[model samples]
Target: MRPGGSRLECCATDLRPRPPPPPSSSPQDPAIPSGPSLPPAPALRDLAGRLRRLPPSCGPVRLIGVDGHAGSGKSTFAGRLARALGGAPVLHLDDIASHEELFGWTGRLLAQVVEPLGRGETAHYRPYDWRTRRFGPPRALPPAPVILVEGVGAGRRALRPWLAALLWLELPAEQAWARGRDRDGEEQRAFWDGWVPAERRHFRDDPSRPHADLLVRPGHSVHEGYDVLPGPAGTAGQGPDSHRT
Candidate 1:
């Protein structure tokens, strides 16, 4: 087990015009092929607007937390949400985590990213080079209207108080791990062996789902986007205990 609360601080297009567009069909239409959902454009736009309007949880930034299992599509989902938020900045936890300290980079993150942002200043953090086992050059993260922190443990207890909203990708653990393993392939097989158990322990003690403001589920296809629903926390930006089990 690793230490917790280590200190510190905190779109696309298409083109091709071959045939006329199909008749408008309600999303509920069963006959509709689950292929072009595209992150529920209208919903995402509304969410973006809401997030922008929210009071900044950090100094001048609405720090949104996107938490989920290792391979539950947090990165992809955050990328789409960022575009919907008009190019909002996103901080991937992967850049902060390393082989030896997989879930123990909180101190580095707080000092490098959160503290500066909390002070209404630019934050610079060195991204970890997994291949080299060392941190890289610093990258700056300005205080934006909305900034997404995406990865596992993003909504952990220590960071929840600083989040404007916490979103959890709803997916079964076994399935998510399987996808992660497959994505990493044989080269990272040993890594996965160590990671799976660590992740399980992390979630077991500091679960994020019960405190999520929204629950996101990927659609049937890559193009199908995602389906966002009220999470166990009920209304977005509300109290964490509002719907905790």
Candidate 2:
């Protein structure tokens, strides 16, 4: 809630690796544990191709929100998909959230990002400055053809109506928490203690997977499989009301 309280102005990756090689196209086989999946270049391109074709679900943009427990590999998966989409823009919840607000930052998001995007305009948001423990200057996000919103609550009800699709990082809560804690290291252990239940309450009340168009479980490698989740609200899935082509 820095200075940009709400009024919206306008608008608006990388490649890493795999725990093992990407699974066969079917992706149903257990992930081979021998090594990580280093996806072949062609497979990466295919992801880009398919994502490019998803019907535009947001006003004029195909906005896909990736939601899951923190450290559930949501950031990594979103980065890969963004690259596949030829550098599609990814908005991380970390940028919008602060230690103070945590899950309470939704109103700022709607004011700064969703409202403008709904009108097919670019939007701006003040990313939280973690080190300073406060928000910094405003950053602008253009309304691209495909905008990937990645974070824990990217698929919350307040924002779902404006999204084209919701994807759940299907890893279990404990596992995700472990990964997140490991990633942050001992430095952030205290912060994580409080974060765990805050996340639980957030999901318990406004879960997003029930409305996910895809449930993504990252294998030992980077390749991902998407399961079609049934739509929970009018906001998602392959029902008669599904927005997917």
Candidate 3:
């Protein structure tokens, strides 16, 4: 989502709720590198090329999802991927989620963003103001070839049906939560305390990693920042024209 005006809220830990780690082992997508030595740039380029060629999953758009544990670096990864896609529009779930709704904003998402895009039209949704605890004016999101949905629940069951690909940021829960807490600091400590259990409950019931087509692990290399591994879904290696329900 565009980051102009008062839309900037204390988004530090909203999506960074911590949950227990899910299972690790799964069938692999042979297209991804198995070793730790794989260069990150080429992998991301390959992913971008593959995604660009994929058939649109929602209307005229190839809606890609970047979902993982809070503070797992979904936003940063999504921004880089968007750049790789030549400035594809990114819809941050933070704009759709509110203090009252949180994960309960699915209906609003469908009505405001998904449905319009599915109908080959521009979408407009009121971004929530976290500080004021109110929603602002409607912001327009045009239908781009590859639009990214980035946040904690970007790959929820309700949205998978409309995604060209779902990518999970591979990071353990405790580690990710620690990173989130450290980033947010004491100011958000109370919020994180409540968010942890809520996030746990959400993930325990509706997990995203299991359904992901690609698993992205943060790379230690400063230049090449991420390694895109095969996810449990095993569909990552398929041709761009392939489909997944």
Candidate 4:
């Protein structure tokens, strides 16, 4: 199942055409209010510590997933969470996805990353270069004690089975998408034009919210820290208990 192997031919055929992008519309406020105030930094740190102690779901790695809309601060949050976990490795889905195969990376991820890590070996996969529209050289990922998979669909059904915990950023789609578009700027507008719709369709078909172990919302304080609440999928009993302020 390794990359550059026979599996790739079948994987390529599994790629589906991108759906038409959704119609443009004004951004709307989230229907639900941001969850209760976040616990203090000490509590968050405690949660991270506990996660670091969890039994590895993949080989010797406790694979955590940070999933949310494109602009829902997933990368920033994952970075902070990684630091809290004492420098866990992070795998960005952006590197696995290409312009032509937005959500068609499950096979590649499994073959190049997950399977190897599951076997207690270092995983190497070619990262896609969006600017060049071609995959670059292979990147090495060590099978650390804790690893984070962050991106829009990190919690998809295909990946959940391998994750120790799935944390969903509780931001509304419209607002998140707006933030993403704004962050990328006018130059990437056309790309966003197509991305918006594809994202919408992907979520519609395989929503991740209901499967999240924790619903993470920004903190009410000036620093805008973050709050982690119990989600429909329920906590895995390894992190801090759900706290509401």
Q: TM-score, each model?
A: 0.79, 0.74, 0.79, 0.79
List where candidate 4 sits over 4 angstroms from the true fold.
1-40, 219-222, 235-245
Best by lDDT: 1
- Once model 4 is optimally superposed onto the true structure by TM-score, how far is the C-alpha of residue 98 displaced, in angstroms? 0.6
Worst 10 residues of 3 by lDDT: 5-14
Residue 110, model 4, lDDT: 96
Q: What is the C-alpha lDDT of each candidate?
A: 0.69, 0.64, 0.68, 0.68
Q: Candidate 4: lDDT over CA atoms? A: 0.68
The true-versus-predicted C-alpha distance at residue 181 of model 3, in Å, is 0.5
**Candidate 2 per-residue lDDT over residues 1-245, each given as its tens digit:** 11211111100011332232121110011222222354324544654555556666665777788788886667666766676677789888877887788889889998988788878888999987666777788899888888999888899888877776667777888987887666566666787788888989999999887876565655544434332233333232234421110
Q: Which ten residues in a row have the lowest lDDT in candidate 1?
A: 8-17
| Predicted candidate 3 versus true structure: per-residue lDDT over 17-86, tens digit per residue | 1222112211101122123443235445556777787778789998888898886777767766676577
Name the Cα RMSD for model 2: 10.1
- Please list the Cα RMSD from the true structure of every candidate, rounded to 1 decimal place: 10.7, 10.1, 11.7, 11.1
Better of 1 and 4 by TM-score: 1
What local lDDT does model 3 show for residue 3? 14
Best by TM-score: 1
Runs of candidate 2 with Cα error greater than 4 angstroms are: 1-44, 221-245
